[model samples]
Target: MNKHGLFQGGVAVVQPIDRGMTKMLDEQDDLYTVLLEGKLAGKKVQEHEIVESINETIRPYEDYQAYLDLAKNDAIQFIFSNTTEAGIAFDPQDTLTARPQNSYPGKLTALLYERFKLGKKGFQIIPCELINHNGNTLKEIVLKYAKLWDLGQNFVDWINTDNDFYATLVDRIVPGYPKDRATDLERAWGYHDKLIVKAEPFLIFVIEGNKKLEKLLPLKDAGLNVVVTDDMQPYRNRKVSLLNGPHTTMSPIARLAGIDTVGKVMQDKDFYKFINDEMYQEIIPTVALPKKELVAYAEGVKERFENPYVNHELSSIALNSISKFKARLLPTFKRYVATNHKLPQRITLALASYLKIYGGRADFEPQDTPEVLAAFKTLVQNDDYVTAALADAKLWGEDLTQYTGLVTLVKQDLQSLDQGGARQAVQQINQKGD
Candidate 1:
């Protein structure tokens, strides 16, 4: 049954096979499985690895010098990753077997080296890691690995000269198959395939890489929003600004506002207007993209937020608030600061909610500062206490404490909410911001 259960038993479970998948599957052990719990599982490949998922294949081949060659010969052009920002980390002592370098970047370097050695062709890697500059970051990691391994200047030059990495914006809400409909899905497929993941119908892979990759992949021609451009910055700017930028700023506020999911807050007429007009309309103009593109992009974001397949909770969005503020909110704030010569009011309030959340209240990691923690603890009790918060330039980078007007309003909002109540605070902010 194809989601609607309309076709029912007429549906089939077929692994979409192109030449790329077929080649790797032929060398079965060359792809999947790598001593999970002292045992190998999944279909065997030529490299003595079992055929698992895309990432699993990369795992066994990562550290090997011949990694790039295998990918070239197999016609495998892309590497899609969904690892966390932390996942791309590196450890100094990571060896061939035990640590396997223990990082997405290190692991990827090993794979690239394998492909490069085999046939000396570039792999068009499109990492879906949701990290800033996914391709460039991956490329940087590969270079780092080469240096660490003492693989010589020639390898580094080869990497610099012959690699094509695509920094991609992948926007499919792949919630890893419907657990709720386990029985029906299993019965319909007529077999058990744990790897059968579920993703929203809407899939977008926007790559800012080599222009030649578009002609090779042609995912856009396959009815996907797979755009290829040298400047992924504008697209990245649009999404980060319209979708993620608004979402991050509003999430803690929404949680404080008593709104749970993005869908719920969006349903409120006035709240939606505030977000659209204030957040998107007002802030989006500061970006270089045309207004129409911004609107269309934001409209798509609303649907992605409403995707029933994924439960992207507000609390989840609230993780690592400090770093997120730096990556997501800080950029927009800086732009606004550059223009207005002061902290943006809505953004300031958003930061205030974050400060309120950091009072030993949420599950985020606090930046290891006793003063910072102490201020958060104190400020949680007194929402209007912008003096201490603004004074801590280490956090805010400047004295926003003097922005008493904004602080007073945020304090009023913060004071009204019950202690540790993200929902109520969020609701109030949404209403006021509206």
Candidate 2:
């Protein structure tokens, strides 16, 4: 919205009291400003005085009554927030009358109650959190808080009928406050703007809604890459499985193979082939969307992985590999097995590599639960490590031993990895895949 001229109507920045990052916002806070340097060269890019650029009133939480008065007078029409992924949580401790609540949903509930009391109009609420069904999740949390506060059925009905909660998928790489180039930028811009944000050219905001939102937003009219769809699930799945799944599954395998970054991993022919197979053969086959669309998304993911500009460290991606595996690759593994009556070779090999990575030989340390680390620490020394780890239902959420031939296959892969290295292990799996 800031990139476009839509925010010329002005935007308000309300600090949720418990966000903990309020000091960053409040420290020498002047005019709640941000300088958006547009990447596009055509009509979308325009020069504006720094003052006209994101000049919103920074409302402190102590000034809740002031915002309440604004609500009462119907001063605000739209509420847009990017409070991070963990922002939309329910806090039972928050109350309607206790100044303001701690959680974002709680604060929203209090403000909406104020509006409900004044019989004011409903406002469109859009949350830019990365969680699935974010808008619906926020609404659920708000309702939970509303009921928890015993705010009566009228306010509840008003919440259900009046406001609009939009689940949004926001994609942009905004590395805030480019500290490295700040001196050069300040000299070039002829201003010491502390709020200048550096972002990539790519931007996408997909809203899950019907035609009403389409007519309301009309962001596409401004040449923005905004998509309004009835179902955001397909987009969400495509991104998660194709983009995130490759990162999660490949991190341990590449790192254990002495590869440091994703770009370097892409440089290796065998490792690159394994990654391609993981996406095209294992992951893409499980997606319910159109095959062409999935293939294109996968190709884009590969390009991103191979991006020379991005130094995506495998060690960083390997953080919490256990949970990442559960979220990213496990579903596809299960689905492939159920459909083909055989394990996904690439994912199974990746899992074996994960076990080795967590076995504490990699240059980077394993960051996972104490139990998981402890299990791997002891199991790595044992001959039956594969069987033990697979059978431990706590680790995988299921007794993986029930799957026929899975244990032997994983054990063989682990043996090959121990005897040779990551390259040899990948060669063994690639040969099996062939």
Candidate 3:
């Protein structure tokens, strides 16, 4: 909506009742500049320009009552949210009478209830949270809250029958506020914009819906990479396998090899080749989408990862890596095994590098839940640590030891990494033809 005049409406920018944050946004007049800094930067006439050319009003509101008032007046038609993965969860402690409900679902339920009282048409909800079936999950939790608060059967039926919750997968790399070059950017732009956000050229928004929804939004018609489909699983699989899988797989290896940002990893020939082979050879084949489409998306991912302006740190990507591995790479690892009846060498090596880093062998701290960290502490002490880690069903969600040759392969990779370091292990793999 910023770059192109896709929608013509007032955008209510709601913050979480933060007085200071709301004050800052108010001072800026709810205006922000998005610095296009990568491959797509050349497409635009100017590198730094307010893409909000359309005469759209952006009003910042921090109170829940303000949002409820918008709904009460039927000012809201579409709802979009990105409250993180944990945002759409249920909190039993949340009540209807609170100033604002604790969980995102709680707040949404209150808004829906207010709309219900007015007997207004339901809003088209599109949640950008990074979770499987995000829209459905959010709807379920909202209904749960309705029952908990005894909001009535009529309200529940209205929620189920009226509203359309779209499960969406959004892909973009927004490294906000180029602090290193902020002074220069501020001078060049001829203004000190506090809300400047830098981003890569790549973006894709996949919403699970039908042609009717496509007609409603028309984001695709506006030349944006927005796909409204009945089945979004294949697209989701492609993103998780190709984009996120590489991030999780390479971060530990790169960090262990003394590389910092993702750009530096792409600059290294061996690391780049490893990531490419992992995606094209191992990950892409497992996805249900067409090979050509997957390849195109993978190429875009490569360009985004190599964006010099975006300093995506390996340490940040390495946070909660255990869960990330399970969500991103483990499925590909299993799929490659089931499809080809063999181990994916690069992915296996990634798993081994994860163990090495979390086991305290590398010069980096592993950030994860306390339970995961504690489990790793004991598992690494065992002589057969690879077997122990793989056998711990609680860790990987299943007994990975059940898979034939996975244990032995991961152990061998761990041994190779321990003896010769990450670069040597990568070289050995590269020497062997894929």
* Residue pairs clashing, model 2: none
lDDT of 1 by residue, 1-434 (tens): 12333322221111211112323433543332221111112222111122333322322323332333345555455555655444444556654343344566776676666656664666566676666787787788778778887767877877777777778786554344344665665586455544344444554578886788766665665555778877778767776677777777777767766676666767766456656654663477567878887777777777666554454566656655554665577678778767766556567667767766675544444542344466577665665455566566656556655543656755654565446465544445456553
Q: Report every candidate's CA lDDT.
A: 0.58, 0.73, 0.81
Per-model C-alpha RMSD? 10.8, 6.1, 4.5
After superposition, the stretches of candidate 3 with alpha carbons farther than 4 Å from their true spots are 1-6, 15-24, 40-46, 51-73, 90-102, 147-151, 319-323, 355-401, 405-420, 432-434
**Which digits, one per residue and each the tens of the lDDT, describe model 3 over residues 1-434?**
43466666656655542332445555676677888777774353237666443222222233556666767656567888876554666889989887687677888898899899998999899999777789999999999999999999999999988899999998887667777888898898788777787877678899996467876777888888998889889879988888889998899887888888889989999999989888888988888888999998899889889888888778877777887788788889999999999889998899999988888888778987666899999998999888999889877889999999988988898889889989989888877836
Candidate 2 overall lDDT versus native: 0.73
Number of clashing residue pairs in every model? Answer: 40, 0, 0
- The order by descending TM-score is 3, 2, 1
lDDT: worst 10-residue window of model 1: 10-19
lDDT by residue (1-434, candidate 2, tens digit) is: 44575543555567664333445544535332333444343223323244343334445465677666657645576788876544666666778777766677887888888889888888888888666788999999988987898989999899888898888876554445555666876798676666655444456778886558765666887787889988888877777678777787778777777787777988999988888888888888888999999997687667656654445567666656776676667878888888788888878878888877777655668876555688788777778777888887866778889988999988877877778977888877777783
Judged by TM-score relative to the true structure, which candidate is superior, 1 or 2? 2
Cα miss at 238, model 2 (Å)? Answer: 2.1
Candidate 2 residues lying further than 4 Å off, grouped into runs, are 1-7, 14-73, 81-107, 171-199, 251-262, 268-271, 311-330, 345-431
TM-scores of the candidates in the order shown: 0.65, 0.69, 0.79
